[model samples]
Target: MTLLDNLLFSLSTTLPILLWLAGGHALKRTNRLSDAFIHDANRLVFTWCLPTLLFLNTARSSIVDSWQGDLIGYAAIFTLASIIVLWLITPLFTTDRSRRGVFVQGAYRGNMGIIGLAMVVNAFGTEVIPLASLYLAFITLIYNLAAIVVLQAGQTRLSPLKLVSQLFRNPLIIGVLLGLLWSITGWDLPGLANSTLQGLADLTLPVALICVGASLQFQSLRNNRYLVMIASGFKLIVIPVLAVGIAYLLGFRAEALGILFLMMASPTAAASFVMARAMTPWGELAAEIIVVTTFFSLLTTTLGLFMLRSLGWV
Candidate 1:
């Protein structure tokens, strides 16, 4: 694809996200969406829609056939490593304990399920869906567990046993586990069941994004601009450059290398704000990071892809 092609692809993937975000913000500003409604909607997405989305994506892939062991390994290890790096470095930027967790989570998490998958399919076509789905399953599991740990550590001390217990009870983790079981057993969801699950899964992103928008407050964002930029920079630029550079050196090439870059470069997940709100008091900071990274990733992703194309790396 040409540079223009790259630009259009970036726009296509991110534009709808911005539009939905704008709609939510407009509703909130105009009093069309109330605080109580946003709260309930967030609870609904976090508890049900997001998990169903995970299950459907994971269950639909035949992991045995679609598995890319090296690709999946790289994605998982890099995600954990990024979280650790952020955890260590975040303290230098802020002394606020609550904001520390929110900042670190925002910096490392990506919208891989939605934005990353779209970019991969557009770049490599439908043949990759199975592999991408499997990748999403593993990485998302890591993202949720890691987010909880960090956020909890930032807020208060907890025993490892208790944390493990809580993690297992999490709806997102349960969904991924069930999906993996289905994939392993090679069971097909009966037609009606599959359609119903898909319908519920489809609501995840839109509702999550709208809730993110409604939660956003301009005053909070402006006040936290410095931290917001730092998180956005890591999400869109630093993490991708470092991770993709290492992947290239480690012999990833063509489609594998491209997927790595796109996933790494994808903006902060909309779910970050939901997760923050549900788990901590710093959801506003997470919302700011999401909005900023979602906007700037258009430029960073396009330029990075163009450069990789020119270098014949992908």
Candidate 2:
């Protein structure tokens, strides 16, 4: 396909997410949806809907077909490199030590579970769910742990038991583990049960996008404007370019390369806000990062995919 074709397709594929986000934002402005409702909706989606979606997709995907250890390892390398680089550069960027973790996590830890998967499914197909799931499982863990360490830097002491307990309580982690275990069993749920779960899983993406839109507080970015811009730039631009280089060096191509790109290029996750709020006082910065990364992702991802497709890489 031509470059324009790729751009159009990319935009079309991603428009729904943007629209849902806008709708949510509009609803919030009009006061049609109360803050309490938005909060509850976010909680519901994170705790139940997202988990169901992850478990359903992972359990159903074929492990043998999707196994790509090299791809997984390479992606891990990208994630770690991002974390370390951001952490090292923290001092140069900001003086607010607590918000430093928010910036670092914002730069590297992408919305792989939501935006990444959606983009991959648009570009490739459902055949890649298992591979994506594996990548998601690995990075989600890394992101969570790294965020905690950075957020806790020179502040409250981190207890090993608390870390373990938090990991256990994290719904996403539990969903990934259960999904992998169920995939191992290879036992299909009865039709009625399966369909019921599928129905629940189907609600994840749209609801997530809307909640993200609703959660956004534009005024939050005002206090930390420059910081938000720098962090969002890293997430949307620098990181994706670096990821492309790594994928090429690792000889990833076609859907593998594309998924890797999504892994890198996708927006800052809404979950970042959740984690920031729970772990630090930097929730405002985290929310702004989400706003900037997600809105700009529309353009960056479109151009990124177009370039990749033009070269026959995705």
lDDT tens readout by residue for model 1, 117-201: 9999999999999988998889999998998899888998899999999889988889999999999999889999999999999
Checking candidate 1 for backbone clashes, the offending pairs are: none
All candidates: TM-score: 0.99, 0.87
lDDT of 1: 0.92
lDDT per residue (tens digit) for residues 124-240 in model 2: 877777788777776776776676677666246668888677666777677767877887787887799789988987777666667667766777668789999999899999998
Indicate the worst ten consecutive residues by lDDT in candidate 2.
148-157
**On a 0 to 1 TM-score scale, where does candidate 1 land against the true structure?**
0.99
The residue pairs that clash in candidate 2, if any, are none
How does residue 86 of candidate 1 score in lDDT? 94
Tell me model 2's lDDT, rounded to 2 decimals.
0.77
**lDDT of every model, 2 decimals:** 0.92, 0.77
